[model samples]
Target: MGTSASKLAILDIVLNGLMRRYKERVPDVGIILDAMVSDGIVKSTSDIENDHIAFRTMGVPQLGVKSFEKIFLHFGYEKRDHYFFEGKKLDAWWYSPPRATDPRIFVSELRVGDLSEESQHIIHSYTNEVTVDGIATDPVDYLDLDNGEAVDAFLHQPLWRTPTTADYQSLLQESEYAAWVIYNRYYLNHFTISVHNLPEGYNTVASFNDFLEKHGIKLNTSGGKIKVSPDGGLLQSSTVAEMLDAEFANGEKLRISGSYVEFAERKVLPEFASLPAGEIKRKHRRDGFEAGNADKIFESTYTTQTGR
Candidate 1:
């Protein structure tokens, strides 16, 4: 899709944040993508723990995936179950890729042989499109492998750019790129910060042309991909930078960064932090909840630092 690079940039940012927060507890990369496609956002920690409580007491969580199969069949947008693991169906959320919300993301379905002469000519027009390591190769063979699940070679190896439009005549083309969205978590102790209000250096730009022009970089922007500069190229990222570069004529940048202790002091240690706690206790009493296995204990310990 035309916006594929932009979306990838966003995913990179969210993935980085998730890794930093949960570390080992953070779900796999695949799970993050699947969740993004269906819900457009990942659940908060409190939300996940709440669902876990629901499973133990009420046998259901508000919206969390119950089993792995539910994740695949229900959330992954898969029509049928394709794989399973050790009698327990694997969660599709961990396997499926995220889809772009922007309509410009869908591309035309081109058949192997039925491609028009114009299409074939267009495919050959590009210098590096039909090559394996820049050497000419049979396009038919590439298409054949592409039809199968040999996407790693076809998509990554290089091929003619595909138009991400339902009809070729439209002005608004779809993006073929994958994307996922993440919300600022309440647990992160920050309110939902808008794109505006970000500091200068922590921002990223989304539109390729805007980023290039603003930064005084030169590149041909006719098709989707832009040629990289000899220098380190545009530092594409999903953080506040993109928001700063958005099509907002009157918008300001957003900034919300602080230490873990600062976040905890503001949000988790506040009186309202107990909202989840209250709900948990209430559910336990109503359902006669029995703590399962007793491996992990839900305890809160707070320590304050005082400067001398």
Candidate 2:
């Protein structure tokens, strides 16, 4: 799929905004880039191809995949496969880029109603604040998607009131994903690194992981250091979430999960094995995601991984 140059320009601005803030919030982004440059992985950060970027949402009528997807769709992204994480009480989807050079998008939403009544109440008490005239609101409905500045601001802006420490803790006990969305509304969750493109010695998750550990970067060990797809076509790993000194309501302070970096290695498809290395392209590689891999990847932000 393709869009007009004007729209593409706006998309660039919006994506740049998301990544800029993401890198700032997650220090590992810069740490990894700087180390990569020093180690001759590439000349600079620009040489690393972004595999994908992800976001989390509250699965309510006001905002979720149905509402948040309009922004990218307007910019020419085509919605592809849908993934459901029953254990996490979430639903997710992946969107293909308008151009091969752009990163894919992975967005997931919390199934609020599935939570315990108390947990649901705590989430609604805050999420319910995002309203105008007592009716649920879809924040993106008012955005001029073509206006890059406004959209960029919206991505970083808070949609609800600050969550109280008690409410946040209660939700966290039941669903870490819920607690995350409650505080970090619409913040880019994680941006991925396509390790397969790096110089030969650092071209796989295993090798890149060793490089990261040597530089003091922490890896999420929820499922294992590496979460591989059943077919062995996709392998992944991520940094344990960076903890932030969060300030909740009433001056309550606690260290909370922020964001993290993910590394992905998508092996070339079997059918494309005969293709010449110079001739192979993104299409010849494993496409889309594997739910089994993503399920563990989600824990990158969970306390289980972050606390490690």
Candidate 3:
């Protein structure tokens, strides 16, 4: 395969693995992705260019942002700007890709210290059970940059022990972030499609939302269906996560919201709008994420938003 083709193949393998695990948890991902293909929005899964993929982690001494990010860093992704969500108690950062075709990465960790002591104890109890030092050692074993299998393994590795139903309910009352990570572990929380790369008439988030709604997908309306950046260069929307059955550590099974997909439309900068469409590249478009928009989008999997 050519260089571009080789990169696409690697991305395809990574995405397919992530999607398989995601679909196993949230069936709607298969429904939505299949519809995207059958409806002609994307000729095939490989045709859709992902703007970014997000992961959620716990902010603890051992397995927070630093440990998890090592895998992506091994793959040549560089850390970028930091974003803080006071209400959500999250500290996040976006990673730039080594290659233009590779998707950007956004990762956020729940500030365990910000939570009540009781909540912190509940979270740490699980983290402590998983690793003696609270730091994850799985990713360290797979630090080979060329090992695509290692990257895939790191993405789906289980990082903590499941919590009891009572503990989960308690965590939910205090911090949904805590409850989510306990169950979902290091799975891909969401992946965004680059709407700007879509064909005309469907290149905007509004139009894409229409297409998703037409297929019976319900979107998260926490801060309105579309969250726009201050400069109006970045637009985003996500479907409320599908509810999935979860068996607590106590053996009580309950239906809870799982991961969801995201759509992003990045407009060309004012300076680039005058250039021909063919002349525009990824750098010409809005490249970074917006805190205001991401803050709302983060609710896509919350019970309040997903109605689970």
Candidate 4:
């Protein structure tokens, strides 16, 4: 397949795999995604250019960002700048795509050691379960990666046993990040729509937020409705995660917040756009993500935000 074809094929596999598993827990993905198309948000799923997709993982010895990033690296993505969140205990890195049109990848790992001892033990117990089961595998196999099966397997694989209600409560009290990864292992946290590519009236995050709210979608308002970078190069907003039923190890089913979608609009740098078209050597749009922006976006799935 050609570059565009190959990108779409991989995305199809990832999105389908994610939605399948995500819908098992939360049904809003299909509802919102389908509505976006049916309501003319974009021509179709294929026409929606993604700015990035994010994954959340535990920062344990065996499993974390390192293991998860291999899948993208095999597909020819290169690691880019790193971001740190002191309050959230997260360390993330965004990867540059092999092809410019391909959506960028963002993966963040919770610093397990930084949490309270009880929270750390609860998280480690689950990561240990995944490690013992040998669910972790190399994502660099050419045949499997090219065919998109490997990526699907990686995303859908269960890396941890269910957490007990008591343990989950303990983790949640200390760090909502820990609670999230323990229950939802290796699932797509959120996928972003490139707002800059949207049609004239909807090309900005503000307008897109207006459109989403009109459809009854609630957005994260922790920092603000829209999180803008200090330099005003990146603006972002996200829907509050939908709450869904989750069965714990103790045989208790309870409602919990699940994944949500995000929107981003990257502004063109004045210096870059002012250059003659042929003379511009670098990408015109702001390239990296803002740590402050992402920190608030991560809270979209928190119980306090989702109110599950």
Candidate 5:
């Protein structure tokens, strides 16, 4: 079969898998699955698309994700990119905070391609160092209250300070779920994946080893991803309309979420073009170096001068 047909056929299989699982396990695991599926922040080439941050830092109890189908119908399904990952699709739904922007709600569809290198680097850096508590401690920990305490309470720290091949293998020997989560977050930071649409491919399935190498990129052969659509699913109308807005549509508005319009109008817009500049020359000089450029330094003695 053709690549597209193969992809779509695999999607059908994934959808069936999700449906069957949902039927079997909704009452038991639906809530957890719903939150995880809906609260996704990073966008892969394929996974869950149309992540509408209805509430910014101040609103939602946790970062939430849900499909438009689930929002409108309370029923949804997940699919696969091709034949990559298995059993990775989700049909669950979640509830997030209400919007504070225009009466009409807007959803932002951010693809892996849309992020800057610095942003990607931060994500990558944090992924390895971050623990579940570290990640959830700030916002979700404060927001999601279960009997005045955080839900899903679990201490999360990096399995290894510096992961090698052996580290990954060792992680696999531990909880596979935790390993995959770390892998996914780390992968999200380094590479750029396309998120063109939904009902198609949502997350890339390429293996990390292959990604590091120059071989062909591979989608997950086991787990499935959410669907993609050219129009960005429900975001087409909301985000596309933002593009048409006279004041905010011009790319500056691109970074700010629609939910933050009030904050933008009152605070962010005034400081929109403002940036603080600091001189690094003195800091560098203070760290120690004679005013001479050297082509080479002692490899053994080369060191960053420390601040007094």
Candidate 6:
């Protein structure tokens, strides 16, 4: 635990577990990987670099970013910039991975208080279950973060009772994110592919988007097919969260949004442009995330993006 290397190894196991479950839950991940192979982008899925993975959490007592972030922080990830999605009534932060090769982490929390009284009621009615379950304080507080398996299991575990269909729709009318966590609590929201290092044609967002469309993958077109930072150093695109056949309370079935796949192209810094590609590294690229770019990327799960 004292050595970063030891913790990094454990972190790897946790990350693999997250990706495994995410891919199984979101078939688009498998579809995208297969397309990458067929198009000769990479020999296999392992040849792809994961740019980052994201999670969505509820902002309530004993939860949200502060509680959820403890797992990664214990390993080696460093909390980075703060981002607020005003329109979406959410707050988020990006974490720098323990190692340069590791994927960054983007975590967003629903501002439950920002919601209307009824919406807050719907959210608390479910989150309160976590508290009632005897996790009176932060659930992560009881977790041994060094145990990779335990942490992995916790991430995939449901934090609250399944919401009734009516409650889900009610939250959906206010915050799409709230409706999502009510059912998909602590699930890996999405994992990103580092597209900048891919082959020439498939390395850029535009080219990657073209390759994706050819393979019948749906892109989140909220901010258009491509979202670029004003500095033009970061580019991103993601698949719309595919609707999953979810069984709600009382055996009620409905198709709701699940996770998705994201592609990111982090351009080399102005100073590193002269360096050969082989010599360039993560430090030589746009390091963190962009608020504007991430704002649109968030809609990958929103009905506005997924319904199409």
Identify the candidate with maximal TM-score: 2
Task: Give the per-residue lDDT of model 4 (tens digit) for 240-259.
Answer: 99787788986898787778
TM-score of 3: 0.91
Worst 10 residues of 1 by lDDT: 293-302
Writing each residue's lDDT as its tens digit, candidate 6 over 178-261 gives 999998999999999999889999989999999999889999988788999999999999999989999999999989999998
Off by over 4 Å in 1: 1-109, 127-133, 137-308
TM-score of candidate 5 against the unseen true structure = 0.19
**In candidate 1, residue 13 scores what lDDT?**
48
Question: Candidate 5: global Cα-lDDT?
Answer: 0.22
Instruction: Write candidate 3's Cα lDDT for 1-308 as tens digits.
Output: 13344545555576578767776776666777798789887888788888998999988866789887876675567899999999999999999987788889999999999999999998878787655354544444435535566567767876666668888889899888778888888888988888898887678999989988988889999899999999999999998987778888868888877789899999999888898999889999988999999999999989889773
Residue 262's C-alpha lDDT in candidate 2?
96
What digit string (tens of lDDT, one per residue) describes model 1 on residues 1-308?
Answer: 23245444443443334334432222221232343234423243222111010000001111112221222122122232222221111121112223322100101111212334553333234323445666765443434321222321322232333322222212111110000001111112111111111223312223422433444333222122222222322121111111111111133322212111100000122333456543533222211111211100110000111110
Compared with the true structure, what per-residue lDDT tens digits does model 2 show for residues 12-64?
A: 99999999999889998999999999988899889889999999999888888
Q: Assess each prediction's global lDDT (C-alpha) against the native.
A: 0.22, 0.92, 0.83, 0.80, 0.22, 0.89
Candidate 4's C-alpha runs over 4 A off are 1-16, 19-26, 132-147, 274-282
Better of 3 and 6 by TM-score: 6
Model 6 spans with C-alpha error above 4 angstroms? 1-3, 132-135
Q: After superposition, how far is residue 148 of candidate 1 from its true place, in Å?
A: 24
Model 4 global lDDT (CA atoms, 0 to 1): 0.80
* lDDT of candidate 5 over 164-186, digit per residue (tens): 33333343343222223332221
RMSD (Å) of each candidate, 1 decimal: 22.6, 0.9, 3.1, 3.8, 25.6, 1.5
What lDDT score goes with residue 38 in model 3?
92
Clashes of each: 21, 0, 0, 0, 32, 0
Consecutive 10-residue window with the lowest summed lDDT within model 3:
1-10
Evaluate model 3: give its lDDT.
0.83
